[model samples]
Target chain A: MSVLLSATRISKRFGGVQALSDVEFSIRRGEIYGLIGPNGAGKTTLFNVLTSVYAADDGRFEFDGAPLSGLKPHQVAARGIARTFQNIRLFANLTAIENVMIGRHVRTRAGVFGAMLRTRATRAEEAAIEARAAALLDYVGLAARADDLARQLPYGEQRRLEIARALATEPLLLALDEPAAGMNATETSDLRRLIERIRGDGITVLLIEHDMKLVMGLSDRVLVLDYGRRIAEGPPAQVRTDPKVIEAYLGTGATSATRAHAEPAPAGARPGAVPGAAN
Target chain B: MNRAARPRSPLAALGVILVAAALLVLPFALAQAGTAWVRITNLAILFALLALGLNIVVGFAGLLDLGYIAFYGVGAYVWAMLASPHFNLHLPFWAILPIGALAACVFGVLLGAPTLKLRGDYLAIVTLGFGEIVRIFLNNLSRPVNITNGPQGIARIDPVRIGEFDFSTTSKIAGLTFSGPIKYYYLLLVFLVVVIVLNMRLQDSRIGRAWEAIREDEIAARAMGIDTTSVKLLAFAMGASFGGIAGGMFASMQSFISPESFVLVESVMVLAMVVLGGMGNIWGVVLGAVLLTFVPEILRYTVEPLQKAAFGRTIVEPEVIRMLLFGLALVLMMLFRPSGILPSSARRREREGRQP
Candidate 1:
């Protein structure tokens, strides 16, 4: 598979703390890439750098062969990298469909005067946007509640709405930061299916999830990070069995023998135990 | 189906038509009652225009602009400079109106551009300063080179005229005697209608949607590929344009201009109209502006007479009582409705039907 996004020596610092230190990863086109790490592992920071929410201090990244350096967040979005926030950031007062329509903003080109005049072109464009937004809402199974205010939707539906909104940008690489963070079992599995379906549409997904089973079950490859550095990078099976991955997860004193006794099962299993536990 | 999917009933259509008809005949009705009433109505319409403009910045864009009257001041000064005898210039009302609006729009951009990064109260403070700065300039710019004519103000401003028909002079049209105030009433009404239509169209447009998005969440709006800085600037400029238009009309209608008319209280008063009526609802703002304007006058009629009857001499003045009641009404409305008398459709929906 061709590489869709590549980062080299990406680093960021926040005051006295190093948020990310020379992290590097490449996401292949049409692959489900999982980024799993403990809290403060710089997963969201990496996403922020990629999406140009914050500038990388050390290195650069490329999207579809073009360097993404020095671009603004909106410009990055225009380049087809869309993301969801760790905390859901829906336009709370807007309708679900309106939220999705706003996602279609980069694709549409009607300006102030055109919108004010409601010219034939603007009308046609607006109609297209509405139809597309509705389709995206339908795809996410929230079509029935298209007119409902985004904040009025259920939690799971709000997540789906965020995804629908991200998809409305017509992104090539979709980055989701803790999309399944608050979801229950059924919702997480549903999200797994949704991610797979998104890949089937030929868009690659870069997911940062704490759920081990969801990540291992869905990701074609998984990268592990600890303390702002990559500890392991391989398929789920290989990464799960890696001694260093376990050491990073369960801390320095953990061994392969105690790995089985770990509360959350081994690396690529259910996520009920701490990854960096000392026991 | 969406709740808004309900088809428009004929009754609603007829209600709209009836309201429009009443507004069209309101001046004539007031004329029969007293020309003074017509004059008040004219001022109310002008304030309505100012309120509508302020609503765009505060309501649609969610930018708290406390100094909106500065744009009005800018527009009035532009008109006074071009069309008044103070400068020995006599431009036509048509030419000066747009010039005034453009000047205000430029000022809006100038004020908005530097402060785009600030949000909420910081933005409000900067705008407040901007309004004061403009007023101070108009007040003191007469020194060295006399521009605004200092505190003495500009007078003999030209009234709107079309060829031989001057709006300041009375004319018999359709067997009806159109007085100056009555003529201005119709003129301001037309401007109000145009502004209202433009506002409605903008509220439904993509730009309007973007503004609301920015209002709801600025960071999320940026993620959605909205160039929020430019959009916010546009909101400021557009909102200021309306203020400028109203200021030009005010100059023409009053045939006088002064810095005292564009004080910080004017800005707060326009904001009160927006907040009291409903920030995002167009009709609610019109209602707020009309009520705020007429309420003072209505109090004068009732309070002055009631005071005379109750006491031998006037102890409490009408102005003080009007202000007290106005403050009390605002406080009560905020405590009860919070969203204003007619909240925007989105706010109303969220409040009424929001699921847990």
Candidate 2:
């Protein structure tokens, strides 16, 4: 499979803290790529750098064969990379459908004159955006909640809505930051199905997840990070048992955190006891 | 957006017709009691234009612009310079209004470019400074170039003319005599209606959604591929253009201009109209502007007269009392209806979400 996005020698610093150093990974098109790490593993920093939320101190990126460094977050989006925040940065006041419609903004061509006059083309475009937004909402199983304000959505629905909004951008790569952060087992499984379904529809997903079951069972490949550096990367089966990953997790209290995440979950469902949900 | 989905109520339609009929005839009725009331109504319409313009910035885009009146001043000065005898140039009203709008739009871009990074209180302070700077320039540019004519102001400015029909002249139309104020009233009403329609249309469009997104969460908006800078600049440009058009109309209607007319207080008053009536709701802003305009006029007639009847001499200036009441009304409105008299749908959502 051709690689869709590749980062080389990425580094970032926050004053005295080295957020990321020489971290590198490439995401192949049409695969679920998981990024796993403990707390302060620089997973978020790498996500931010890839989205151009922060300029990498030293790095070069190639996305779909185009250089993707020094671009703004909007530019990153325009280049077909759409992301959801870890803490859910939704347009809280907007309706669910409106939020999705905003995701179609980069693709729309309306301007002030067109909007004010509402020309024929503008009308057609608006109708299409609404239709697509509604369809996306339905795709994420929140069709009934399309009219509700985004903040009014239940926890699982809000996550679904964010995914819907991100999908509306028609991204080549959907970067989800901790999708299962607040989900119960059922919800996490639902999210897993959704992510798989998205991949089936031909969009690659780059998941930065702390939820172990969802990541290990879902990702085609996994990259492990510890102390701002990549310790191992391979298919999920290989990376989970990597000695370096275990040691790094052990350095920061491994048995409780990484054991449950790196190894498989206990067979029975834990209901609301999602390890990452505590975050 | 839901406006098209929901069927219009018959009662609401009837009320709209009644209001339209009243608006059409009220100026003529007021002319019987002398043209002063009509003129006041005309000014109210003018301020409505200003309020609608400022709404684009403060309400739609969620940018706090205290320098909004500077665009109005720019438009007024553009008209005064090109259309008036002060510069010996005579561009027609139609041509001058567009030029004035364009000039204001350019200035809007200029202001937006530098202040793109600022938001909230910082934006307010910078905009406030911009408004003051424009006013000061108008007040002092008489020395070297003599452009604005200093504190004496620009006078004998040409009134609005359309196809040999001067708005300043009284003409017998149908069976009724249309005075200058009544003529200006119709003209200003036409402009206000056009502005209101444009505001409504734009409010439901893609660009409007982008603006709201940026206002809600800039980073998320960016993540959605919206260039926040360009969208914010567009908001400023639109707001300034509307202000410019109103400013041009104001200058022509008054047949005079001065720096004092576009002051910091005027900007604050326009902002109050937006906040009080409903920031993002066009009709609400209009209502706020009309109420604000008429309240002071009503107070002028009652307060001093009542004070004179109560005592021998006028004890306190009515202006002082008017300002005090204005402040009180704003504070009370904010405390009671923070979302505004007719809150926008988004604001209504926020307000309702706060409740059980």
Candidate 3:
């Protein structure tokens, strides 16, 4: 498969502390690439760098072979990369459909004059945006709640709405900061199906998740990070078996070493084991 | 599919039509009541236009611009310079008004470009300082070259005229004699209508959605591919454009321009109108501007006379009472209905079915 995104030696620092260092990964076309790490392991930091929320201190990346250096967050988004926040950041006062419609900002070209004049083209584009936003809401099972304020939705539905909003950008690559961060078992499974279905739509997903079960179950490939460095990179089964990942999660000692090898081979087979089990 | 049908739509349309018709006939109906009330109405409408402009910045874009009246001053000065006898320049009203608005738009961009990065209170402080600076410049620019005529101000500004009908003078039309205030009333009404239409269209368009997105969450808006910088600057410029147009109208109607008229208090008053009316709602801001304008006038008529009769003197002045009451009303509104009288639809939805 063709590489959709490739990062090289991406490093970022916050004051004196290094948040991310020499982190490199690539997402292939139509693949679900999971990024797993311990808390403060720079997974979200890496996502931030990729999305251009923070400029990388020491490296560059490419999206669809276009260099991503010096691009602002909005510019990155205009290049067809969309992301959801680790915390829910829906336009809470706006309706679900309105929130999703904002995701079409880059696609729509109506300006102040056209809007104020209500030109024929502006009306048609607005109608098209409404239709597309409604379709995205329906895809996320939020069609009925399209007119409801986003904050009025339940927690799980809010998470789903965020995903729907990201998808409304018509992105080639979707980066979900933590899709299953606070979900219950059913919601987590639903998110898994949704992520898989997103991949089926031919959009590559780069997911940063603490829920190991969801990551292991949904990801085609997994990269593990501990303390701002990659510890393991492979398929879920191999990454799960890596002694370093277990040591990073459970900590250093004989106890963690024994638990790392004593765990059953098919533990990842269960779809919903524990919420934020690795964190 | 399950969205609630807005049953008030037809009723609201009828209400609007009725209000428009009343406004059309208001100057004529009040013709016998002296020209002062009609002039006051014109002033209120002008302030409404200004409030609408400020709403685009504070309400839609969620930018706290405490110095909005500076744009009003810019537009007024532009009109003063182009159409005033002070410089022996007498451009036509239509030609000069647009120039005034364009100048204000340029100033808006200049101010916004440097200050958009500062959010919340920092923005407010910067805008307040900008407003003060503009006033000071206008106040002092009359020195040496006598550009703005110092504190004495510019006079003999030209009135709006279409063909042979000069708005400064009364004219007989359709068998009815229209006075100066009546003529300005109609002109200002037309301008207000255009502004209202533009405001409504903007509130529902893609640009409006983008502004609202930035207001809700800047980072999320950027992540959604909105160029927040350009959009914020556009908000400032668009908002200021209305202020400029209204400023031109103010200059022409009053036949005078002075730096004293564009005080920080005027900015605060316009901001109060937007906040008291409901920030993002066009009609709400209009109601706010009108009520805020009239309420003090109404209080003057009622309270001063009562104070005179009760205390045998004007001990408790109407102006002081008006200000106190206004401040109290704002405090109460913040405590009770923080969203204002007619909250924007989004805010209304969010506040509905919630505990007080």
Best by TM-score: 1
Question: lDDT score of model 3?
Answer: 0.87
Q: After the best TM-score superposition of candidate 1, give how far the Cα of residue B297 lies from its true spot, in angstroms.
A: 1.4
**Cα distance off (Å), candidate 2, residue A30:** 0.7
Q: Ten-residue segment with the worst summed lDDT in candidate 2 chain B?
A: B347-356
Pairs in steric clash, model 3: none
Please give the lDDT score for candidate 1: 0.88
lDDT of 3 by residue, B15-76 (tens): 98998899889998877677778888998999999999999999999999999999999999
Regions of model 2 farther than 4 Å from truth: A252-279, B2-7, B308-315, B346-356
Q: Give residue A47's lDDT in candidate 2 (0 to 100).
A: 92
Q: For every model shown, what is its TM-score relative to the native structure? A: 0.95, 0.94, 0.94
lDDT of 3 by residue, A1-279 (tens): 999999898888999879888988888999999998777788889988888888899988988989989999999998989999989999998989899999988988999999888888988888889899999999888888887889999999999999999998889999998888778999988888888889999999998887767888888999887778888888888887677766666555423444535432221212233323523
lDDT, residue B179, model 2: 85
Instruction: Name the candidate that leads on DockQ.
Output: 2
What is candidate 1's CA lDDT for residue A113?
80
Expressed as tens digits, the lDDT of each residue in B58-146 for candidate 2 is 88899999999999999999999988888899899989999999999998998888999999999999999999999999999998989
Stretch of 10 with least lDDT, candidate 2 chain A: A264-273
Q: Is candidate 2 or candidate 3 better by lDDT?
A: 2
Which pairs in model 1 have colliding backbones? A249-A275
DockQ order of candidates, best first?
2, 3, 1
Q: Could you give the C-alpha RMSD of every candidate to the true structure, in order shown? A: 3.1, 3.9, 3.9
Worst 10 residues of 1 chain B by lDDT: B1-10
